[model samples]
Target chain A: MPTRTPMEVSIAVAKAVQQADVDVIAAYPITPQTHIVEHLSELVANGELQAHFMNVESEHSAISAMVGAAAAGASTFTATSSQGLALMHEILFIAASLRLPIVMVVANRALSGPISIWNDHSDIMAERDIGWIQVFCETGQEAYDAILHAFRVVRDPNVVLPMVVNIDGFNLTHVIEPIYLFEQEELGDYLPEHRQSLKLDIDHPITMGPVGIPEVYTEAKKQVEDALINSKQVILAAWQEFGRRFGRAYAPIETYRVEDAQILLMTMGVISRTAMGAVDRLRDAGKPVGLIRCRLWRPFPLPEFREAVRQASIIAVIDRHISLGAHSGPVGQEVRSALYTLPNRPQVFDFVLGLGGRDVTVHDFLEIVELAEQYATQGPPESEYTLIGLREV
Target chain B: MAEKVEKRAIIGWRNLALGCAILEPGSSMHLLTGTWRLQRPVVDPEKCNQCGLCHIYCPDLAMTKTAAGTYEPDLNYCKGCGICAEECPKDAITLVEEKE
Candidate 1:
């Protein structure tokens, strides 16, 4: 029987990793992500988990070390937050391109300029094209489940791409929730004994990441791109199987109360729950508003997104990070691009809010919905995005 | 034991080893660096000393000691860097511009 325990999300994440029986974990601690690696180290020290827990010098070294470990056919894992993820930026591409199935859990946080250690999507937004399978979790339970599903999808024979499980820093990462932690035997055959087909073997004597001279550079990249797109099948299958066994269903796009709603509010990460509450209140108030949460970010899940917004006439896209010079936020930009080809696409209203861990409540989401409806009459704003909670001088 | 590895041509991306990893060692030998040479080194066996300085100084290991104890460069793999000519104690090697 699975044990449901009320534990800190980070600790629960560590327990999930322990359950997966990861062979190596090389991580550098950063706030919001510290508890995760910290508990993993404790598990290793206490003889609870038989794995090599490496306290790496930096996130760069952490990811680099994972690449080496994964290439050596060892199941590897690592966790990091904002600046740490940014530090691993260079090696991130290398890990994905080299096709090492190293799983990483990113406690989503704001990137620094004024040096804030708070929650936001800036760090991951900066790495939108890293070619890794990226997913966002709305709750601690989802975050914990995502870790197990990540190992299954990435280590699959046809999908040997690295994966990133993004959980909102401080919001979801530091929260204490009742999570159903499964025993190893309960996960029977979910993740089999990992044996990577292509790995660094002294007996075989093969080189990895060899110079892809001009002759095969494009094709080499094409291969990884195809692998990432193709991996969606395995990702969905893992989620389906997990739900069948564990009873918590997940999808690329999760919808709530869109039956006859004419307006939809789209969100990602922890804010989705607040948006769901806002949808409930709005429905009670006779406003035809619904909610759509993007659970999968990479490979973009175009078909599901389009189908989710099929009946809605307008969509209010909530983005946590401003794309600097771009007219809209990164998530908003992607939504617009994805919906551009449709003859009857929904009018997407973009909002930039909750940066550097500012409090976002159901009230804030309600106002966003009102503003989206208000702007729908005006046929797109001149500024393209409404910056929520920005104080005026 | 080190196995005998042969040089092979690059394959298409579909057939390329995972991540384009080179499975065959010593594949660099097929590159033919001799065509990169702007000048060629010629050895004069008559410079009189059998000192092996030139053999030690050739960066590419292109110089080989003949049975007579004189070093001769295999131009097929030599890029004519002239390090052997400069290091020869008796000036037994000369650099000559390659013929067009």
Candidate 2:
């Protein structure tokens, strides 16, 4: 049996990577994400983990080094947030297109302009189309378990694409939580050795990342798209196997009290815990309300998402970042797009909140539910999305 | 050489499953670049002192050393970059424009 211990979320993440026995860890330190790589470097220094710990100068070099290491048949892992992730944007696409099974943990943080080191979806949301399988975790345990599950999904022979496990910046990474840590012996049977047939070797030299002219560029992109879309199967299989082994079941769309509700408040990350409280309060008051937390972000889980919201009369999507001038927030736009074809689709109200680590309380969620009800009765909001809990100008 | 052509066809994206972008190791050898040349490098055997400068400088690894120690360019895979001709210590290599 795995031991349940109290540890900081960042420490738990590092321990999970250690158990995964990654061959290389190349990362640059950035706020919120610093503790993850710091613990990993300490593990390498203490010889607790037998791996190459590269203290690269910049995020670009960190990702670049991981790309080379992964290409050379190494089970590679890296952690970054905000600007660090933005710095690696160019290489992130290459890592996916090359089909390198590199796993990354993004301590989701707000992007800079005013220079704030706080939690937000701006970081990962910007890189959504980079073609990596993205999963958001609501807690430290999910973050740790997702790391192990990410490797299994990415390195599968049928699905050799990169993956990113996103955890809210200071909210989850800096918090201490009781998590069940898997022993290496137990994980051995669950996750076998990483085997890649297309690795680089001197004896069998191969040219990778060759120049693709106009003739083959579109086809190359199509191949990558198809691979990313098809990886959903492997992801589902890995999660199912993980549940069977650990007895903690997870799904792409995790619901809370949505069985018989007319109003559904949808959210991602740690904020869902708060939303659940609001749902309980509303239910106690004889209001039909529930919650839907999105776990899978990439390949969108369209069918699962459509089914989750099919019965609700109104859905209030709480977004951590805005899409500027779009009809709704990023998540809201995606939800609306998924339900566009349905004959009797529920009205989705976009609620933008929690930018730059702003505290979102259960009371705030209750207010959002009220606003969503008003919108459903009348028409939708006049603007694209309502900025919730904004200070008076 | 013919086997490489067949291997390229087998490994092409059209034949592989969607999103499988990996190529076989040393697959570049199968990509014949000789036809890409506007000018071909010809070596003057008498001027060649067997210094192997052409072999050391060829960008495509097209130059091969013979049993007798003379460096020869494999025109089939050579793009005729003229790097070997420019770097030749004995001026043994000259680039000749191909006839249209």
lDDT per residue as tens, model 2, A1-393: 667799999999999999888999998989999999999999999999999999899999999999999999999999999999999999999999888999999999999876879999999999989989999999889999999999888878877889999999999999999999887877766786899978788886666787665546777787788888989988888889999988888899999999888999999999999999999999999999999999999979999998898899999999999787677789988998899988999998899999988898999999999999988888777886899998897
Stretches > 4 Å off in candidate 1 = A1-3, B1-8, B31-100
TM-score of the B chain in each candidate versus the native B chain: 0.78, 0.79
- Estimate candidate 2's alpha-carbon lDDT, on a 0 to 1 scale: 0.88
lDDT of 1 by residue, B52-94 (tens): 8877878889998899988888776789999999888898899
Residue A116 of model 1, lDDT score: 80
Best by TM-score: 1
DockQ of every model listed? Answer: 0.55, 0.19
Question: Distance from true position, residue A366, model 1, in Å?
Answer: 1.6
True contacts kept of each: 0.76, 0.27
Q: How well does model 1 score by local distance difference test? A: 0.90
**Looking at candidate 1, what is the lDDT of residue A48?**
97
Let me know the TM-score candidate 2 reaches against the reference structure. 0.84
- Position A347, candidate 2: lDDT: 90
**Model 1 per-residue lDDT tens digits across residues A5-91:** 999999999998998899999989899899999999999999999999998889999999999999999999999999999999999
